[model samples]
Target: MTALFVDDRYRGAHGIGRYAREVLGRLDVPWRDLGLDGTPYAPLDAFRRVPGPGAADVVYSPGYGALLRAPRQVLTVHDLIQLQTAWPGRAKFLAYYNGPVRRVVRRAGVVLTVSETSAEAIRAWLRDDSVRVVNAGNGCSAAFTPDGPREAASDPYVLFVGNTRAHKNLDVVLRAAAVAPGIRVRTVVPAAEAAEVRRLAAARGVAERVEVTTGVDDARLAELYRGAVATVMPSLLEGFGLPALESVASGTPVIHWSGCRAVAEIVAGRGWAVSDAHDAHEWAAAMTEAARSSRTVAAPSDAYDWDRTARVVSETLSDVLG
Candidate 1:
């Protein structure tokens, strides 16, 4: 069977692109890369031109952009942040997603989501309970493991790995670090937002203690994860807590916020959870514990490997096609 994988821009973002590549690589059946550009479709014409199950045999979309006219179509919904959050400019974001996108989600033969939290949100927002929740595995590379016996940096520091989005809650981590005075905190933000975050850090008087390094390659990122005293992620939400898994794979302990259910599932009994800090005392204690517990070993991450994810996706596709 030939499957048409629909995505607006295949290479635009790293996360969805990575997942799509992995699934496609593992699929047993032949697949076609159908994108919005250069195809015989107008800009945003993907919805109109999308081949149905009869034409393409089956359709698989890694993201929630495809509206299928075919009998069989599968789409992965990573998160429902738009439905759950009431942040500034929420109306604008909700407007684009409310009508057409919701229809695609409702009409798809199979709706795959990354986490139960997301699955619940989909059901609540779209008012459908039939969506299946599949947990995508997040594994650290062979590179994120202990790098021989390197001396810990003479200075004490904490680390955070995420883009500068409001949901990430970097300020909470920074505030926690500030109250802990002696501990320095380093964050790897996106290149475009590094300057703005740096300016914010300076204004907050934690400038000297904060270091922002942006646009790091995979090797450098591995080193950063391996060498940090601890990795902190105070995210308000996550589809899957990839960084926490990465921290465990690197044998680094983690301090995570308790807002997202996926984090609780991933770190349950294995890692520490910090509730939204009513004050700095709670955060300070969590950071200290994470720093001290830096030698945690998070092996056996193969359960969540790309191969496993691919196999599940392939099986689902096969069932649909048959």
Candidate 2:
């Protein structure tokens, strides 16, 4: 069967965008790209405007382009963070989720998710046993290897990669840095959020110990990963923790919250999981111990390959088409 892949998030730099670019690049099927432009809602417009998929063709979206109506469509839902978390745009998000997103889930032939945890969440939220949800997992990019050139920091620092979303629980890191002393916390965030992170650090009384860097390229990110004492992920929820995997691949230890099952499962033997994400003292002790100990290194398993992911997608689509 032929595939019509939706390239909606191709130009974006978020995890969903990266996933789209990676899997679409390695897919083994004969496929054509359908690009979407304008706002985040543009996909709906594109979906309505584009010609419908033929009987032998399947329309696949790596991101949640669920509004698109096609003969056979596959959607990958990363997480329901907006639904679960309390945010400023809850009203708008709820409206969209209840409107187009729910419609997409109802109409999709097969729904793919990043982890089993996410699959369960989707099933539980939708309360639908008929929905076909599968776990496709995630992989670290090949660039984050153990032999990369390391970046230099004035003092040993624990690295935090990802946006400063409320669920990320960065306040714990700031609190831990305040009490830990001597150990710096280096956070990679967008330029717009740098000031807010700094303000939070000051509010927590650890401004001097916290350093925030914005707009780092991949090479720099790898270097930082290589040199960090340990990468910290205090997120309360995650579909599939990519940062933890990347850190382990770079020969750096990772300390993530145990509450995030996906992160815990991904970093099982290669990293440490703290049971109490809210306890600053516990995280502080863990960070200090990680800095003093030898870096724990491990290579990603064969399962973390884009080729494997593509194969799974291909097989799933074939099953749906059959």
Candidate 3:
């Protein structure tokens, strides 16, 4: 059977986009791209009205873009953070999740997730015992090796990658930086939210110590990872901690909140998972210790590899088609 993978989120720079690009690039199956355009939500709307595939064709959506009544449909639900986190868009998010997304997921032939933690969350949230939620786990890109050109920064800095969303717990990082004094925080946020992140830093009284960067390429991100003392992932929830794996892959340590079950589980015995995620003093102390330490740890068992991930996906799709 021919596999058609949806490329709805590939044009963006978010985690879902990264996952789509990397895994899709490595798949060995007879596949074609069903590309979508416009904003992130457009694909969902489009998918609902889009034509169904032939009997010999299988449709795969790598991210959350699900189809209402497609036969032989596969979906990858990265996380159920929206269902768990309290955000301004909670109402709209609930409307969509409880409406179209729920219908699509219930009809999916196979459901792929990044982590077992997320798989459980999906099962719990959907309350669907029959959904085959497979934990395919993510891998760090080969480009994120230790021996790379490091980014140049004036002082020793803690790296924080990803968007500065409320669930990211960046305020804790800023507060920790403020208390740490000597350590700097280099945050990679989206260009649009840079000003707000900077304002947050200023409000926390660590504006000078916190450097917010926007629109960095992968190579630059790898460089930043290599040069950092430790990567801070104080997120309240994570389906799979990509930054933790990438940091370990880049020969840098990771400091994450212990409450983030996926991150804590992934980084266990590889890096530090602070029990007190909300206590700035505790985070500051951990940062100080990480900065002084020169030890490099091995990548977690779940370290990202697109080829391996694609192979698993290929097998899963084959099974579904059979």
Clashes of each: 0, 0, 4
**Full ranking by lDDT:** 3, 2, 1
Model 3, 111-166: lDDT tens digits are 88999999888887888887777888787777787887987767789999878788
Question: Model 1 compared with the native: what TM-score?
Answer: 0.83
Which segments of candidate 3 are over 4 A away from where they belong?
A: 1-5, 42-48, 69-72, 301-303
Question: lDDT of all predictions, in order shown?
Answer: 0.65, 0.79, 0.79
Of models 1 and 2, which has the larger lDDT? 2
In model 2, the worst 10-residue window by lDDT is 37-46
lDDT per residue (tens digit) for residues 1-322 in model 1: 5554545344322455556665665767566655445422122543565543455466677766555364445777777665556666677547546755666656554577666667666667766566445544443445566554432566667788877777777877777777888678888876787887888788767888888887665567767777777788777878877777766667776777766677666666455678763355677788777666655655444666766677777777676666
Q: List the residue pairs that clash in candidate 3.
A: 139-303, 139-304, 139-305, 140-304
Better of 2 and 3 by TM-score: 3
- Angstrom error at residue 2, model 2: 6.3
Instruction: Return the top candidate by TM-score.
Output: 3
User: For each candidate, what TM-score against the reference?
Assistant: 0.83, 0.88, 0.91
